[model samples]
Target: MWRDHLTQIIVFAVLFLGVSALGFFASRWRRTGSLDHLDEWGLGGRRFGGWITWFLLGGDIYTAYTFVAVPALLFAAGAMGFYAVPYTVIVYPLVMFALVRLWSVSYRHGLVTPADFVRTRYKSPTLALLVAITGIVATMPYIALQLVGIEAALKTMGLVGASGFGRHLPIMIAFAIIAAYTYSSGLRAPALIAFVKDGLIYLVIIVAVIYLPYKLGGWGHIFDAAQAKFEASPAPNDGILLNANNQLNYITLALGSALALFLYPHTATGILAGRDRNVIKRNMAALPAYSLVLGLIALLGYAAIAAHTTPVLKDNNTIVPALFDGVFPAWFAGVAFAAIGIGALVPAAIMSIAAANLFTRNIYVEFFARDASAARQAKVSKLTSLLVKFGALLFVVLINPQFSIDLQLIGGVIILQTLPSVGIGLYTRWFHRGALIAGWAAGMGAGLWMLYLVPNPATDHAHFGGSAIALSKLGLDTPKTLYVGFLAVALNLIVSTVLTLVLRAANVRDDGDDTSPEDYVADRSTERSSLAAVASESSGVAASRAAS
Candidate 1:
């Protein structure tokens, strides 16, 4: 440990505690009614306006993992890491088209989770269960990545304890504060703290991009250094620009990631919390600005290359922290670390809330207690949120970080399988429930099989080492590799389309859709005016009143 780094630790601790206080107080922020319901606790009562929605969604998408891992990838592999930039850029317009429809349908039908939407749309609990379980499984490693980001920064600051459990104790304490405030304040905690979290992130990044390049030489020298380092490496594909071999992974990864981003339950939770469709549309149009920041952030890897800053333990993910520690003054470096630490909290809270809502609405309340009150659903969801955070904590503490990273790749593929049931179901219900389930299974199986077979240069060149699988593995006789999610999702769509045609021709009745066409497009007022009698007879009146 660098004993001289106490100043950074102190600054980090101060900002961390300050944000915890803000989170505790956020329980009272924007409160409309009792915080005893899923709508109130899990989704901020679905009442956030445009700006709150923007910060919440931004905080959820541009996470600490983005800060640490994207640059780390660029630091390690070169231009292929820049795929994150394009993925984030393309995701918003897609969001404008798809999620607004999802929001409309969810608001009209009292849906809290994507699984809730699936259950209501396809009228199949089994499919909903699959979606919920997929969400929970996919999210655990994501939350662990946040903890990994915090630990990386702490390790860089020499705040890591002497040895044993003490070494891990600092991060656990920080996450404990996050878990406590999240339990009390729920989604509102993250929504409120997002303001401070994003402010610090932007400040740190803006200062780094402007100051670091000036201090180190210039952008040209930085890129020259990065290109030289990658050129000296053994892999032919490593460089400042994508080559024939890596271009496939780069393009497919970008497209697959864009398709999968908003499909995550946390993103849905953020969007669903928006008070109206207009809020989501406006935020979607504006949120691509974060992608612009992301491109700048990814360049920090080259910045590190130019500065000659070495990663602690040669761990690539720690390079960003090490970069800050090397370049910035001690106090400001601490502030940068705080930015990343607090960045972890916002998304971690949102993700846990999302996973818990999936269980509470689609699993617990749907199965265990059909008559559960809103308060009870919220109660279960809160407790489940605690359990989910605890599970993620254990995941990072007990397991290797590389395994968690691999699972995150798998998570992308896993969540992408639900595109047919959730993303496409928004536009058309032509898909039979049976076909949708089969498509999900086919997609999941293909993705896992491909992952198990693919080897990566990063992971001792072993199978399941990364998300990219070579075309040769699939009989293409080439070195080009494709992102597993892009291929799996393609196969999923084909299976879904073919089976859909087959099932329809068989004249076999499957689980029927319960949602109407207007349900997919109506707001609260329009829903009430058009389908007032139907909504009143159903369970939607309560949601309609809350919407108003």
Candidate 2:
């Protein structure tokens, strides 16, 4: 079965091995004095500048799943999949306002994780611990979603085994390579490999959008074909054009996703790695260019329909890869597959590093090893990253890809609950720590309950059918659907507001904040003295104090 794909496989092998070499050697690219510190190992020394920041953040935002699953969702569900394009558009402006403050404060305080910032800002270890654990739990399934992208590409290339362990071995081996390099080079591995990954993705997307459209009888024919297919289908909301029932879902999903995207620890890991606030600002302005690319990528679903390409596997995630294999030459198809497979590595490495940093800085150091040295923290982070990656590997292997997508939807919902404390708290300390904690709990519980009630007929699952929740399910008279994250977050904000006022009236003691007003606006150059002083405070001392 693999004999016919030898050319494609060989080309993919060369590119894969080349990037693997780069990942292993990335530690030497920007030589820091030591990789013992969390700053050095977990965040690429926080010295990434304009172009590096652009590519790194781009790679972090646009994952293998973006290439595979977004198009797959478009192929399977139509207009709803285009939610990602607008979500990307909406996110940059939001980040421009929110993340610059976060970067300034994190840089000023020498904070390594979002939970670390939460701990200091709220002066409450318990609240920060919730933020840290949410980040880890939300991140694991996201990492698993990236593997789904790789699995889809491999299945299209006929590189996967027939069943059971044989089918999963390729995925495990790929992750092993990623885990090894990430363990050695840490964030630097992804930071460097992102360049190649994004380059290939752009090349493939640009060519496919231009060439495939012309070959498949242009955009008009593609849309007509997709529309015809959806119109004939029995599903009410699966058509090419957005209906009244789905318009709310589309808007809310896009906006909710935009808000949730930056809340994940990996997103912050990318932002925090920048050299200064200007690096973040400039990249935010320029990063919208990827949105243009993403819009084109989403249209590949329609293109696949126009091409009359059937997914090689039962999974819709394989639709784009199948389209490539059927239409493009074997060698070029190989390039496209390589783009996706390599794309997984960049985000997976960053995510595991982010999750591991959260575990090391927020949980392990805060609660378990108060006297742990810098080197000890780095060692723990490296090991934890390995465990996180393998855990994601197991998740993908054991569960279905459709279920993985549902979990990712739940992940966005789960991570959004942190906005009250992390994103909103960046601009104001108005939210009491206790209030924020209660809000997170309320939001999380509501989100999970909604997800549990959604049913996916395709997967024969009763819960976690999708991210869209029906208004009728929420006791509304209308049949319209909306993104569950948005509703849950709204509930969270209301609960937080009412509780903050009540707590203040009752004279509930606030956990006095550690951050000064000036800290929120401090930059790297302006805050050199403060950064130096904070850096001098050993991790052990900080952890011990945080614990006490």
Candidate 3:
């Protein structure tokens, strides 16, 4: 069977190796100075212009999950899978200006991670440590999910025969390559490789959308097939239409995802790498176009059903890849497989680098070596990245793939808890550090408990089932469920608000803010001391006091 797919295997190897070569070459792509500094290695010297930043951010945000897991969701869950589309649509407009402010303040302070921002904004090292730890923990499974995206494709191609260790060997080899380039080149590896990755994705998607529909009747027939399949199912929620029971869950999932998107350290890494506020602003405006593509991609699930394509190993994640292999010529199917493979590479690199940056700056340098030079920090970050990727590899090897999925779901909920501390902290210093920590603790507790209560009917798991939970769990008298992230964050905000009042009234001694109101507004164009020379080199900053 593997021998039958040799054409595809060769094509995939060629493209995968080519990108690995490009990853090594990226170290020289934009050589401002030595790659010794964390600023240079971890953040690409923070000099990415409009187009480069556009592709890099696109690569980071629209990952292999976009290609595999999302469509897989549509294949399995019908309309609920479509939530990714709306959440992406909602995120860009919301963060367009908000992130610009974050960029400005971070640029001014030479901040390398969101934890660094928290540390500076509240003058709380303790809170910064918490933020950094959350990022590293959250990213491990997120990276493992990326590997799943690739493994799904590999299995579809018949490259990995049977199951067990041999099935994952190719993935291990690919990540070994990824780990090497990432350690050597840092953020530039992903930033540069993103161009090739995005171009391939767009080409495959365009061809699939137009060509697949023609081959499998029309759009009308595809929908009819999907609708019939779902209607015949015994599941309570599996139609093209969103029923009343799941409506609240859908809305809250979308909104909560939108709010939590940039709060992830990897997303922030991409945004912060922009050369100026204008680049980020332009990107924010233009990036919604990906959402349109995402919706089209989700439709491929329906196309697979219309084509009567069976998933490899009965794994829904392999549906899109299986669809391509079943219908398209071997050559084009290989191309599609390569797209999914490269798709995994770009984001995995960025995520490892982002997590590494958090450790180097927030934990390592902050605690162990306060006077650590930028070069020393960069070395630590490079090593940390390898460890992070290894941890992700362990998740794939030792754990059930289902737990990887659940962990990613839980990862979003876990990261959302930081939004009040990092996302809101960017615009306002209104909340006390003690209150932020307490609020964070409460949100983490509630989010974990809610996730524990969720059960997966598909897998027949009794706990840690999924992201949505029924209102009855909270003593409400309805069948309507809400996103765990959405509910936990509301509880987080309430505790933060009430605690802030309590702490302020008690005159609790605050560490005070290290950032001035002007830090958000002033850029390199306008001098704020010797720092203005560095800040003016690029552009990005929000007004000191933006309206909430």
Where model 2 places Cα greater than 4 Å from the true spot, the runs are 528-548
lDDT of 3 at 155: 88
TM-scores for all candidates: the values are 0.94, 0.95, 0.95
Clashing pairs in 3: 276-539, 277-539, 277-540, 524-535, 524-536
lDDT of 3 by residue, 1-548 (tens): 77888888888889988998999999998879889988888889889999999999999988888888877777777888899899999899988877988888988899989999999999899999999998988888789888988888888877775577777886687679889999989899999999999999999999998898889989999999999989988775568888789999999998988887888899989988888888888999999989998899889888888998887877778999999998899999999999999999999999999999999899998899999987888899999999999998888776555423455677899999998999888788899889989999999999999988998888777888889999998899998889999989999999999999999999998988999988887555464455665565533333333432
Instruction: Report RMSD (Å) for each prediction in the order shown.
Output: 4.7, 5.9, 5.8
What would the TM-score be for candidate 3 when compared with the true structure? 0.95
Candidate 1 lDDT, 410-522, residue by residue in tens: 67988999999999888888898888889989999999899889776555756767898888989997988889999999999999899999999998788777789887677
Worst 10 residues of 2 by lDDT: 398-407
- lDDT for 160 in candidate 3 is 72
Q: With candidate 3 superimposed using the best TM-score fit, by how many Å does residue 481's alpha carbon deviate from the native?
A: 1.4
What C-alpha lDDT does candidate 2 achieve relative to the native structure?
Answer: 0.88
> Whose lDDT is greatest here?
2
For each candidate, what is the lDDT? 0.87, 0.88, 0.87
